[model samples]
Target chain A: MKQDSESIQKMMIILSKGTLENVYAAFVLANGARMEGINADVFFTFFGLEAIHKKKLEHLHVATVGNPAMHIPTMIGGLPGMEALATSMMKKEMEKIDMPDILEFLEILTASGVKLWACKLAMDMFHYKKEDLYEGVEDIITVGDFYNKSQGPGTHILFI
Target chain B: MERTIAGNTISLNEEGYMTNFSQWTEEVGKELATEAEINMTPRHWEVIKYLQKEHQDQVALSIRRIGKSGVVDIKEFYQLFPLAPLKTATKIAGIPKPASCI
Candidate 1:
């Protein structure tokens, strides 16, 4: 099916990981799409739900386990303080480039008209309440609803 | 490289975006638009003017922001530039590429 010029409007981004970099990248693209005159929505599911969790959003860490760049053994990633150290290092690097921290980035994205959605299934699995999410989450929705809302001509869906 | 239009020398980066906003003039904009194969119209000038003002303030320019700025709607903005509106419009406006576009 093809959409005529008028129907092409929205861009949907599915963020299924809570890694600091993944969330950052999603917002960057979402911001870009919105700036380009396209409506952009980001759906957070699975591990991605951590990105919207009130407390965790301020303290996200890169996943050293299974991360190709880590080079160290996966078992070492589980050691105490490893994640914290990694998180601090990432924050410092981002600061060097003037990139905002996670909390600030979310505010920027929302202010720019990027819609944020939380996956209902993931929320229940993680035992999170609506109050536990960040300020800009528009709704708690199922994957079906995500697909439903994403329907239209010229809709671009990306899984990150 | 540089293009001299109406006795003014405007330097462009390798990709052809203007390097100095001070050197921009309506004549320079027309020349740049011609090189991009875009016909200069009053509507086009509105977008270019808006972009130059925003650049001076260091505001991040986007299609939605420009549309909301009341200079022109998104549809008309796209119709005027047609391909890569932000990139093309910024280039012809003699401003740097918008951060979002990069």
Candidate 2:
């Protein structure tokens, strides 16, 4: 039946930015898929590796510079503490909406059975070892391995 | 819309969630669970009861809230209902579909 092909069975989200907004967007999408009875996987690469890095995950900041949505002048947005101010405000709003912190969200994703993968190339480029990644990460895999694991008729890949 | 469930005609929403909670019975829940392809255990009943209580008190339902509800954790909740636990469980509980995404 065409129904099988029309329905979304899996989501493969690739996160390539270290910004807090991007990381949360990827996490929420992956978690939302699982909540809807669909399988999901997140592949962290490039600057996104920071999201799974044990020591850096908690300190991610919203990108205020060059973000027109921030509504502040670019020069002002680039000032010291601007990103922190924006990040803190965003965090407060997220909490108001019952969104979990990055660490807790990772735990929830793991508990919800969303597989998390770290890119080998990015890990090596950043000199991050497996132990340096979040404990929930399933493995450090190459791009080819990620594509291989994510294959399916109804599977969709998204880059963020 | 009205549909027959467990031999009882029930009022339901467009998404098939029950519109009247009073019409719900354990038997209806059983049949709904069967339709959702879940075999009910005592554990499943417990979560349904918790959801019913929350709905009665007008508490919003979300995966995050359910995980923090102390009745069941997220992992076991997924295992219990297996697919779309919140929506399926709420449907069986005869409550309105939750608008929560988390």
DockQ of each: 0.13, 0.65
Show pairs that collide, candidate 2: none
Off by over 4 Å in 1: A1-8, B1-22, B26-93, B99-102
Instruction: Give the Å error, residue B97, model 2.
Output: 1.1
Number of the top DockQ candidate = 2
Comparing only chain B with the true structure, the TM-scores of all models are 0.90, 0.96
What is the fraction of true interface contacts found in candidate 2?
Answer: 0.74
The alpha-carbon lDDT assigned to residue B99 of candidate 2 equals: 89
Which run of 10 residues does model 2 chain A get worst, by summed lDDT?
A: A1-10
User: How does candidate 1 fare on TM-score?
Assistant: 0.67
**For model 2, how does the per-residue alpha-carbon lDDT over A40-141 read when each residue is reduced to its tens digit?**
999999999999999999999998889998898999998999999999999999999999999999999999999999999988888999999999999999
Local accuracy of candidate 1 as per-residue lDDT tens digits, B1-102: 887886899898998898998998888888889987799988888888888889889888765466568787655766787656788899998898876531
Task: RMSD for all candidates, in order, please.
Answer: 6.8, 1.5
Question: How many residue pairs clash in model 2?
Answer: 0
Worst 10 residues of 1 chain B by lDDT: B61-70
Q: What is candidate 1's lDDT per residue for A1-160, written digit by digit as tens?
A: 1236665478899999888889888887886775565778999999888999998988788887888697768899888888888888888987766577788778767755678999999999999999999988999998899999998778989999
Native contact recovery (fnat) for each candidate is 0.03, 0.74
DockQ of 1: 0.13
